[model samples]
Target: MSEAAFETEPVPDRERFEDASHVLHGPAGSAAWRQVLYALYVVALLSGLYGFTVTRAVVERYGQSWRAAGAVLPVAAGGAVLVVVLLVLAHLAGRRRGPVTPDPAWVDLVVASSVDRWLTLRESWLLPGLTLLVAGGLLGGVGGAALVGGGATGPVALPVGLGGGLLVGGALALSWLSGQVRADPSGPSRRGIGASLGSALRMRTALRGLGVDGLRAHSLRAARIGGATFTADTRSLRLEVAAPVSRGRRWRLHPGGRVRTLLRRDLLGLRRQPLLPVGGALLVLPGALAAGWVVAGDAPALVAVLGVFGLQLGAGLVAEGLRQHGDALGAPRLLGGSVRGQALAHSGAPALLLLLLGAPVAAVSAGALAGPVAAGAAVIAVLGIGAVVLAGLWLAAFRGQPPMGAFGPNGGPTTLLLWWAWPRVLSVAVGALVLVRLARLGAGEAGIGSVVLVALLLGVLLPVADSALTRAAAAHRG
Candidate 1:
């Protein structure tokens, strides 16, 4: 065929591209899925508002003192900031892996066929955009309520909410822009306003334009990917080693060398997943504040018991984090015959930290807010709560399921884990009962004989429950 004749005929790829263009303008999901997602969003928003009202009421009731409000607000704000920081760090860490580069099939069909990259990316943007909007809105609503509780009532909450939403929205938008710039430096999208933002986000220029060098360094540290440098295009990231510090001779802490090895590996694993440890620690701080608030109120013992509940919940979440890392690393396979021993070692770090850190903080908060008696009781109660947390972790680790399915496949229904992990559920129930019995004893609602009876029953019951669970697990696995 002549060149002119060939040009006149349709290219199959070009024809396909033309047809695909029609479908690219809208969402990828079906209309029904979109409607479901929208409904979920609305429900979430309503739930957030309800939670705000309840939190505000609690502050009014127990934290009526200006001093109490002052203490709580800063902690809440710090927590919000910490969450944002972790998310940003995670994003940076993901970016270091690479952007959503099109596969060979997509490249041949879309890129080669001359479709706009922006159109190709548009559908992907919708979910992320919706996520930011919902999260920012919820955060704003909570913050506004907190402000109101902190004596900024009337129209002040409106401004605070708007400001918070804008701040969060802007931050997320900038991060998204940065990611885009990194993804395709030469795309048409970078020619206008995007160029400036992208250049600012680029690590080399970040120091000059936005002074994000420190933030980038912190992100690297938090991501546990130190000695790596991220470029404008994070895919082209390079590793740069700093001067090595001398390995100082360290004493072997654990009794057995085998035990030491297991502990060391588990510790390294925890360090590698800094988000869980850092975020969990930050989360527990609010419990301390809650204990303080409740202990200051009318029903000191009852309210303090409730405060211990908060601590238990926080501890449970921390345990979940540890469980997640354990599951991810397959600690079961790593330890083999010593599964029980290794599980304890893997779980030891968080439990020990909870005891060491949580006990003192809970005691101090109770002492400061209530008195010496409450403080002493808080110390005892926190000790038990910590032990319960460890028991929960032990149950989860050995059972080969997370206490809350923390490391389950992303977006997979955890209802399945909940249903399957009956023993873990039972374990948690037992722990809660023990805690309740202890709290009752402190509050004079139960006798010491009853408390000892419950404790002994727990000791006897858990072993039998664990044996049954083990048999069931082995049978299921087989």
Candidate 2:
């Protein structure tokens, strides 16, 4: 699509929110809950701001020392303060003088009867860990390497290995537990972390639904909705409705032309920062080429391996970009629904970048410029598709979406992973599968590898990407 056309895709804010599929509320809801919740929310806000301001001042004044630690103290304190705020908000939003929203996935908490419950953990915990783990691991590796080089040994490898093992083991346990619980017929209809999360989500959804009706789980005040306007002093969420709308139903495509346009104009705004993946691939090139050389002497194999590394790097960048996109797109809704767009936008840059990275590398290795160029182009095509699927995951990042924690979420070491990071995983998995299978095909080297690589991009990555984006876009409303 042309840039102007793509950029001008007409979508508006109110329309966007109205078109939102599964609106959700929190547990402990009602009219009274809103007053108390908003108060606590304010408190959390103040605490967070104070913590950030103080932390910044300390960091500016003191070189990364006790001052740094001191900075963390307030943020942590503020976070706790906010937790209290959110809990209260949940209660208060429920208590609003009308029927609160309801989550759709009230089926069984295991798989998320609705998307709201699924996404809570992702927002609360999953995204942070996903963003942090690789960085932390890279740091750990750097630290381990540095310590070893500087003459520290006994304590180093042991922790790395043991810690890594524990992390892996914990993930396995949780995953196994999930399967086991889900398999059990009568064991808490919802299974594993999903069940508990589903319960929480159900509470939010139920709250909104009930809140709209002017009743709360515990509060004395009642709320009522009339036409598009709520009662005075109700302070309920302003929900826009089209004609034919009724109680307990979702908002649809009507929010007026101007609002719809504004929403699109705001979120899809082309303003951007330099994409990180371009730099990432360049950075990883040297190491990847070296690794590729060692892995296989075959020219095609080497090129293919390079493609994998490119995918990995691209995936990571795309993941980060998507996150930032969410930060931007979500500002208006606050519900975090536009994360899907973020994913789409973020992934788009990296997919292009993968082509940039792959084309030259593939051409150089193919013994001929044409071969390398073709290989690189193929690599881009494949990863491009993968990027599309990756966008599905961005939807998964929102407040009510599913928590696809990378390693699973028990607060164990493994919890520090992004389960929603499918693009990265898909890229890696596709690269490996193609490389391994093609390596065996053996046209002595280059030809077989090229064919295999192309196959993967065409057969695996592209299709999956299309499928993922479709699902994510459709469900993002939830």
Candidate 3:
């Protein structure tokens, strides 16, 4: 055969391989349509419910403000914040399991063969991208409907909202693809946004250069992680997603007293995973802002509930030491202290971090939006709430596996979910209740003495709860 003919022959063979693979492995025609229809039905139901409930209520309450001049700036700012958050999350998720992850079997067979990698993987990427696009459009449509119902805008908003959502969704899809390319071990070195975008847009060409071995390894890892998730094997899931410690490796821990050493160890850990503190700060800032608004009476007490959840998540990130301790419950204690003592020592870093980060933001937001009195109260409230949230995160960190009964024949997914989530839920509920009662007291609807008494009661209760959970987890581990 001629050299050119020999070189061109493999291209057709690769195309044929992909075509046959799709015919053999892709979902059946009616089944695929049924899946699509079911997804649409579910999305429509959710959008309808949201439009009639939360969206409508929000639009009714803030519609006039949304229509006022300069409202667009704040709305745009919030949207930008959300976009940044989503992009960060997407990048992290890509590091764990990228957007184009295929089945382990597919990777072993087709991907390991002579077929074009992009030909085999493009479908996997397209499915998720389209799903995100549809989801975004539906969300926007629901919001647009709510705005119209609340008289915030005209019928024109519907198409505009949908168009905007499509654009946002497309951007998100591109970001996800960029993350996948960045995560590829044999791909080009990390580059600027323009470079990433250029790579994503020409993904087929990019895939041609990716190492098949790396893709296979990642595919297998993704499968194992998926299995862990399905079985609720939190430890395995955490291990799978835990990035290697590459930062602060040269930093040495100093010798000190036991408690001091524990605190330093956690701080060192945070230094190693430097992004944890950054992510925690991002979460805490908005939470603090919401909390300030609630405390200053600029927003309803219900807003504090969201703030409590955000604070808990943020604290959880910084409380990795506590979680690691909990995971080591059945093991020997090299740290030479009781589990509870070590746990409390571990809690110090997160609590202090929360206070330092939350207090100033809450104070400023309240002072600027309300007044000096509210600012003082907001600062105090933020500190208290941060402590409460930190304690709750400590409890959640130690919450061991759910009881077998939760997954027994009598129980189901809902029961197991609730069992796993109960600690965080209870903590948020209690925190919100406290904030609401305090708000009422500030508004002169309740007596200070009673409010303080309730506060004191809760302050005692949370520790007892945390201790009980720790003991239970230890017992379960034993």
Candidate 4:
């Protein structure tokens, strides 16, 4: 080869470095970043307009002396302090184990190579850091605005917000620092020493004094020498570790029949892997109940809104249960039956469970004023909501390929606009109407006919629609 040709050739090291950098940081980083920026812009613009109007409305209602708005500050401050303390302690405890271990590829390719560790690792921390900073800033801004609007303090409000943001930001930074310190290979010996000393501190006495012997046992450990490093005992560390658990027991049933076979397997799967179902219920049910209770006194219409929302939450759990089976769509083909019949068989357990769970909550939420008959109607309506939710989720799952654009693998705002979300929204609107009718029934303005009508529409009509939709979707796919 000519000298000129050799001179023009690209360096192998530079080429390899570029390839490694792209893999570490993600090839689509620029596009993803742009999308995030656009999303933020849209959110900011919408929030600014909505917040301005809301602020103006609040000001007009209570003037600058809106002290009621500040009533929750003391409570909020206490909660914030408690949360921050818990986070810090949890973070510290996490550090005892060491920072998150990198992926096998990242360890083998990036760390073992001559490349800078910071460059490869920065991508992991950058997104989290930005998220924390934004969250802190937004929380501080909101709290400050509320305080100022309520006339809690004039000049102090802005400072308070800034301070709050800084406090949160600092906490996050400390957590990141702890992780980095743990990850540093050279610091393990020093960290182990610190752990040993910290383990011996008067904190144990304080924990005993506070009557948290369990915590004391978990937090502190006797020192042990493992090679050159002195570290806390592993027994105490093991005490702090938690294992995942299921929410319910598996049902034992004769598996001779096809339906029974399908149900038995599904029930077992759901009971054994109940985390998602239980977690979704726990996360959503309390908020729904709280909202229902708040509006229970106003009128049934408001309570009905809660009912709809509550059902939606419950529906999500049912859907999760169905998903656990892994045979929702294929059961028809495997078992040789009509799609609709198989779908119904698959959905039976979830629907029954939903009804069982929703009945009491619905009755209580209707209040004593609802009387027995109206209360019965409300309970039935709630069950209907569950059925609808189950049906909707079934259709969404088997009706076609799960939506791909927004909610598919990369979840985003588009997920909220899915066919699944639409049913919840529609349920709320329908609930308002049904609740208004129930309110009239209780007051003697409407007859028993209204009660029966609502029940029929919800209990019978909705499930049929759901079954039909599921069958149609299945047929289309076939």
lDDT tens digits by residue: candidate 4, 180-210: 3432344334665244233323322211221
How high is the lDDT of residue 158 in model 3? 80
lDDT order, best first, reads 3, 1, 4, 2
* Cα-based lDDT at residue 200, candidate 3: 78
Q: Which has the better TM-score: candidate 1, or candidate 2?
A: 1
Clash pairs, candidate 1, are none
Task: Report the lDDT of model 1 for residue 406.
Answer: 39
* Alpha-carbon lDDT, every model: 0.51, 0.38, 0.74, 0.49
lDDT of 2 by residue, 293-349 (tens): 223333333344445655455445434434444333424544234444444445554
Cα error, candidate 3, residue 382 (Å): 1.5
Single out the weakest 10-residue window by summed lDDT for candidate 2. Answer: 210-219
Residues 31-95, model 3: lDDT tens digits: 44467658878877977886557887887886675455234565568678987788777766666
User: Model 4: runs farther than 4 Å from truth?
Assistant: 1-42, 51-116, 143-261, 287-295, 299-307, 321-337, 365-378, 402-420, 439-464, 467-477
Candidate 2 vs 3: which has more lDDT: 3
- Against the true structure, candidate 3 reaches a TM-score of 0.88
**Error in Å for residue 84 of model 3:** 1.4
RMSD to native, candidate 3: 3.7
